[model samples]
Target: MNATHTPITAEAVTRVQAHYENVKKLGHWTSDRRFEVRARRGMAVLDLRSPQIPDGDIDVEVDLDHAMVKLLVPQDAHIDHWDLRYTGRGRVKDWTGENGEGRRIRVTGEIRHGEIRVHRGGVATLSAMFSREFVQDVRRARREGTEPTVADPARSS
Candidate 1:
């Protein structure tokens, strides 16, 4: 009798904190399936379109207070923020709240006087481009004599 074995990966969690400032994670960095974000009077941007991300569901726990959190996902990704607990003007801005055939991201935790914005596909790319990391990537690419990973030359001014 042959028994099929399902490989198991360590459930590593990435944490991001922004207090009165902005914190962003972009580009081809290694990613875990779980995340924790804490923002107070600031903003946090997370890019989940990297190739290093593993398959299956993703989990994000957020704690916001008068802050904003942005998620940049792939075109095919599905976002689920129904489990989030919000108060005051806190809200999750996902136009389509239905599940899709792509990867699922389950969001939980609480938001107080803040917002969570979700951007997919072209919008996500545009959002990523409007950041300091994009400029740094362009400069690094120039120094290395390689094309910038985040920006396209044909679309540049």
Candidate 2:
């Protein structure tokens, strides 16, 4: 969205970060992963919840300036906002799992002039947040070219 003249890097497939200043998408399915985001002045959206990694611990590290990082976490994830320094506000809105052996999402990083918000929900709830058009866009991109997409976030695009 920043549209800055930054050559896009090969988007990470699994256990990688969804960086800024590039084209990226989190597919319909996700797995246990560690997503790192680094940006200077743009927004980063990291969706850690997906079909495969429905309920598990996720590692996230974000470094940004004048940018926002929004993470979509699963409802069962127990989030830990550790060692996270930021000039703006960062918060995690979630609840403990019923069985107490639920997922955990650990977020660590530093940010300035922007906020990092972690929102939690179930599979149905998270899926609803995205539109069918979003999935279609990925399919189209794959057909058109090797445009990086989150078709299967676990697999390198």
Candidate 3:
């Protein structure tokens, strides 16, 4: 990944477009500049947004500065049984039980400069998931002896 501080450029636009085309060829229906993906368990919606793209890939400079994911559960859904993990810079700021009702809660946060801060009531579920995925990706790169598209900070040492 490019550094968050970098500005968007035409080269970045080309890269993003290529990635989108590639993914589409593989049969995914992702075409929006911004998209919302619902979790398999119906517990949350992952909102993704980008500022530039010819097709689907996000411009490197157009970082996903904000991702507001909302978790929705049924009346019988068990909040206590749920676990949240947030991996990015934005933090959840407020979680309110609607009208003093117990079955619903709202989660909101802002991401800036690629850092995520989970608000006090925001669950940490997504962060943990992202961290695990990142580690796995690094491990796979090592096993394959392939340089990652993103620069490796450790190698700069």
Q: Which candidate number would show the highest TM-score if scored against the true structure?
A: 1
C-alpha lDDT values of all predictions? 0.80, 0.55, 0.27
lDDT of 3: 0.27
Off by over 4 Å in 3: 1-32, 39-130, 148-157
Tens-digit lDDT string for candidate 3 (33-94): 22222221112222121111123222111122333333222222112212233445534333
lDDT of residue 120 for candidate 1: 79
TM-score attained by model 3: 0.24
Give the total clashing residue pairs for model 2.
2
What TM-score, computed on C-alpha atoms, does each candidate reach?
Answer: 0.84, 0.56, 0.24
At residue 15, candidate 2 shows an lDDT of 37
Q: What lDDT score goes with residue 148 in model 3?
A: 32
List, residue by residue over 13-81, the lDDT tens digit for candidate 2. 343333445323355544435667776666656666555653335667777676666666555556667
Distance (Å) between predicted and true CA of 6, model 1? 12
Of 1 and 2, the candidate ahead on lDDT is: 1
By lDDT, the best candidate is 1
User: What TM-score does candidate 2 get on C-alpha atoms?
Assistant: 0.56
What's the CA error at residue 37 for candidate 1, in Å?
A: 0.1
* lDDT at 41, model 3: 15
Q: By summed lDDT, which 10 consecutive residues of candidate 2 come out lowest?
A: 1-10
